[model samples]
Target: MPFQLPDALATSDDKPALSLLRRYYGDAVTSAGAAAGAAFDGWDSTGTRTADVDRFTADDLLAITFLSVRVPPRAAAVLLRDRAAELGDLLAELGPDRDLVGEDEPLTDDCWPGWRLQTALRDIPGIDTTTATKLIARKRPRLRPIWDKVVAKVTGTHKHQWEPVRVALREQHHALHERLVHLHGAAGLSAAVTPLRVFDVIAWREGKDRGW
Candidate 1:
């Protein structure tokens, strides 16, 4: 069951998402957060030790900082010490190549591991829901969709986001996914930016416009 995109997502001539992408991530080389996100993904390349599914590096925290979120020393210590193994276990359960648009519906069987990890990350002292999701998305860009307060407000997904976001991406035979890819190229964004991130920015921008 695909999500019926609201009027706010007038995918016709307006192309609000594409415009936002262009405004924020120009040519992928000179935008505000573009360099940071690209740098982070470059560092998190496949086959690297830092790219290991089970653990996070100081670089990961540093990367999110570029996007305006930070994990303080105390929370970082907690993640490194108390949560690494558990997070790794959950990551191992999920497919490395699975994209959000292709996730199984009801989402229970396939997405449960991620949900468990998300819950655990949010439980950390200094990590809120937005920070937790951003951290998870950084590691599994293809598999995890980010949801900050603004994005949640715009999408109206709030505390429950996975199913609705998945449905939106799956809508019209994966129209949103195609739009994201097109916007990435059209906006001249780096390949490092995933489709999920494109959607996140779009929703986030819309939320900001609405003063959320």
Candidate 2:
């Protein structure tokens, strides 16, 4: 089935959820951006670029996920030591789809690396759909979207599964990307936060604040 946003979010008169999200985005720009910047500096000191996941130590994983997604220490540690290389390869293969906007295609697991990565990461202990996708988003900010519990609820996605949610995001990527980009600029946010991050924050806030 083709994906669709819930009617409350899509056509609400008050748009309270969206208002809350905009406020959250502004707060994240100043607050989360500062915290993430400091943590990222520490990460870069270890010479671990986003694509160099193979070079990531347990400490690196802990620090990055703490800064970005707040993944639990134990889970981050396990993922760090065990599946770093596999995760890296997935991100490298996914890369950035510059032509994503141009393609007149429906997203499928076979064509979307995010879906494939979510499936592959399922085998890794301590890395569920939320954590796995957040890790990917941290590495490839422009290409991947984070799908925490809040995001899943807001989007009406199936819990504990990521491909359907990812496919939905891929279908809306172009318009959503443009909106996030506009919001980033209009809000006077720093370049440190990417459009995808903003989208995640917005969706998270909607689910969290409005109980979507």
- The most accurate candidate by lDDT is 1
lDDT of each: 0.71, 0.54
Off by over 4 Å in 1: 1-8, 27-50, 108-111
**Could you estimate the TM-score for every candidate?**
0.83, 0.65
lDDT of 2: 0.54
- Alpha-carbon shift of residue 183 in model 1 (angstroms): 1.5
lDDT of 1 by residue, 96-193 (tens): 74688887566655348788888888888889888888788878887777877777666667656877878778878988788778777877766677
Q: After aligning candidate 1 to the native by TM-score, how far in Å is the CA of 140 from where it should be?
A: 0.8
Give candidate 1's error at residue 60 in angstroms. 1.1
lDDT by residue for model 2 (48-110), tens:
464464333554456456545454666565466556677666656766533233334555546
RMSD of each: 3.5, 5.1
User: How big is the positional error of residue 19 in model 2, measured in Å on the Cα after superposition?
Assistant: 5.4
